[model samples]
Target: MSTWTEIGDRCWVRRYDEWDLNVGLVAGSDGAVVIDTRATAEQGSELLTHIRELTDVPVRWVVNTHAHFDHVVGNSVFTDATIYLHENAAAEEDLAGTTFSVAKVIDLGDRRVELLHLGNAHTSGDTVVVVPDADVFFVGDLVEESAPPSYGEDSFPLEWPDTIDRVIGMLSDTAKVVPGHGAVVDAEFVRDQAGDIGTVANTISGLHHAGTSLADALQHTEDWPWPLEQLQDAIKRGYGALGAPRRPTLPLLGPGSSA
Candidate 1:
């Protein structure tokens, strides 16, 4: 079973597993809001069971952070709630033929949802859900807790820092942040992550501009303060696709060091 911890009177953070992902719940006098759904239908249903135990408040809103499978595939379980997302998320869902139903809301009881498109950040479809009265922000994958940020095919590394800044600006000073993965953190942690990622991106950009071959760039990244093996592989693949030189061998770090 997943673990649920209350952050406030009406807010809770659900940690499914070490790497399973986390979801948030915001309960109001009238109803409740569910942040990202789990990856599978079973996990999503598990979350609902926990919510049912806490309050009989009808679930009125279901907000998806992005279009990634882990973040949105379980949306089918929330057939009764209004499913909200960023406009780009809806568009991507349509293009990818992902099974999501906004129409199901009507059959469930005329529940309606709005898609608020903030802008491009983590992914083109990144969305932020704010509990105005509670002063809480449910940031999907945009702000992670100490773990290294994972950049996937859809991520825009160059624009992620600005996106983090925008999210921090949207929250109040006391607002609690619930990330998609890891523990709940404050605005300060968000700022630090932005700075760290920005530095890594800038370093990579500079290397590219300085005519450093992809192989050399990968080797140089071995000394990066942040964990970047995955990112290095991504860079190498990107360069290889463009017919760039092969990557050079990088020494493996001793078990714990960021190599």
Candidate 2:
């Protein structure tokens, strides 16, 4: 089902229930701004159709919240709109860029979205799209409302809490947060999620640093709400981010081999 919630005067957060994917749309007299196109051409086409129902304004620009496949892979769908990405993503695209340490705001005529690049958070460059006037933030996967945070192979566990802190500072109690996948929530929800994820990061890092084997270290995460596979990935991210050696992939020994 295609459901949309009006967040501001002319802005909406559209959700495709099947994918649990949320895409931000902001329109003004001048043009419209689309945040994060869906993963494929077909999904992006469907999203465009949904956006067309909301506003007739032509989409002039597209902002990828991050360069993940689910987020940026739909770039090809927005042929007429200018695609913008963080410096690192630009590097991958081989485009000359500005390595913004803080953030930069793009004026969408009647609307303004501040792109804050929170270094080493969900990825090497994760940006939170802030609608200052609306007091809403389009947090990619940095803050998840549907589930616990997902740490990919590129995530930096040690830096996520601090990055989330930066996002928290930019929000107000009345602010609404649109996660990558889920219903819109408030600032407190985001804050609590960040705190819990931070705890997981710390626990994983501590266990790894204490020289706990990968299997035993994973046991410490049993109390965590995420899956074992996700925890294992986070453990690897934690170890890598902390400059610890990669977890050695030891072979399982059968009873005969053990003897």
Candidate 3:
């Protein structure tokens, strides 16, 4: 069974595993908001069962934090709620032919869910669901617990900090931040992670602009505050793919470091 943690009368967090993923449920006087649908149909159904036990209030809104399969594939289960996402997310869904489709949103209670496209951050399609009454923001992938931000080909690592700053500015002092993969955290934790990610991105940018070959940059991995073992592997793979020279003498760091 998925582990569920209750944060408030109206807020509960669900963890599938230590590194699996997480989803949030925000109860409302009239209805509720289901943060992310889970990675598979079965998982989504399990989550729905838990929500039903809490309140019979219809799930009026379903928010897709990002288009990652782990975060959005199960949206099919919420066939009755309006699905909302960032415009870029919708576009991604369209391109990939994921189970979710624009037509499905209309069929789901005829609710044309609002898709607000906040510019690039974790992914080009990142969107935060604001529970106005509950004063909670459900952010996906944008904030991690202790893990360094994962930079993907689609991610804007350099712009991530600014996006997080905007999110903090939009929240009240008491606003809660529910991230995509970890335990619920406060705005302060979010800021700290953003700062770390910014640092790594800046370091990479500087090295890249300095004509530091990928091999030379890997040699300078010590410059990063985090460990570089995992990143070293990634770097090696990247260089191999590009047919670039490999570097030696790279020190490895433990998991959760910017490495």
Candidate 4:
């Protein structure tokens, strides 16, 4: 059986056994809004059916927390709903296939879902879904509880901590947070994770600011979470966000600076 927990009025977070990915739903009298379709069409179809069984409200909108394959890629299945995405999210190679960046507000009858692009962090188009009335937030991969936060090649490690801080600012003390993966959590869980990630980011930032060689910096991240290899990979992304190593003259995109 699929596992779900009700966090607010007609709002639920369904956790998939497959990837442990969390999908959020916020419903009102007329319709419902879905956050993060699954990785494949088959998975999306199954999820749609499960959601339909829970509520008769037709799915009116689908929001992608980010462009990651597991978090999106199911847009094709929800043909009737207006898919919402970040403007820069379309640049993601996997999501380049879909038409998005439309409809900021989804009216779930009286209750509403608002999409906010709080700068760049996880990915260029990472989107946060807010149900202010319900006091809930669906933060795609930006907040990870099932596992440690991941920093992909496209991730802005430097900006990630502040992005979490921004989400913290937007939430109420008792708000429920549905991360891209893992169990439904409270604001304090998010705060603790954000603090950890921030420490790692600040360490990398400090090393970079002090003109330490990238190699040495990677070595220094030995005590950070994740294996040395994974830590190195994440640090590299953080470094990339600052600029390419050695040749700082040819700078790439810096943290907190988005298109």
- The candidate that wins on TM-score is 4
In candidate 1, residue 233 scores what lDDT? 47
lDDT of 2 by residue, 107-212 (tens): 7787787888876777776778888887878888888778678787777778888889888887888998989888898988988888888887778876776677
Backbone clash pairs for candidate 4 read none
lDDT of 1 by residue, 1-259 (tens): 6667888657788887836588887776557778888888887887788889878889877778788778777777887887776666778766232223321221122222222445566678887766555667778888777467777666666666677777777766677888888888888877778787677666666666666797777777453547666576445534443455444566777977873
Task: Kindly provide the TM-score of model 3 when superposed on the true structure, using C-alpha atoms.
Answer: 0.75
lDDT tens digits by residue: candidate 4, 1-259: 6766799988899999877889998888878888999889999998898987888888988888888889887778998887777767767654533343533777777888888887678787888898888898999988888888877788888888887898999877899998988888898999899888887888888788877778888788444756566666668988877874453455678999886
Segments of candidate 4 deviating more than 4 angstroms? 94-103, 221-226, 244-259
Instruction: Score residue 210 of candidate 4 by CA lDDT.
Output: 75
lDDT of 2: 0.77
lDDT of candidate 3 over 89-136, digit per residue (tens): 778766232223221221223222222445577787887766554567
lDDT of each: 0.69, 0.77, 0.68, 0.81
TM-score ranking, high to low: 4, 2, 1, 3
**Which runs in model 1 stand beyond 4 Å of their true positions?**
93-116, 233-259
TM-score of each: 0.77, 0.86, 0.75, 0.87
Error of 3 at 7 (Å): 3.4
Q: For candidate 1, what is the TM-score?
A: 0.77
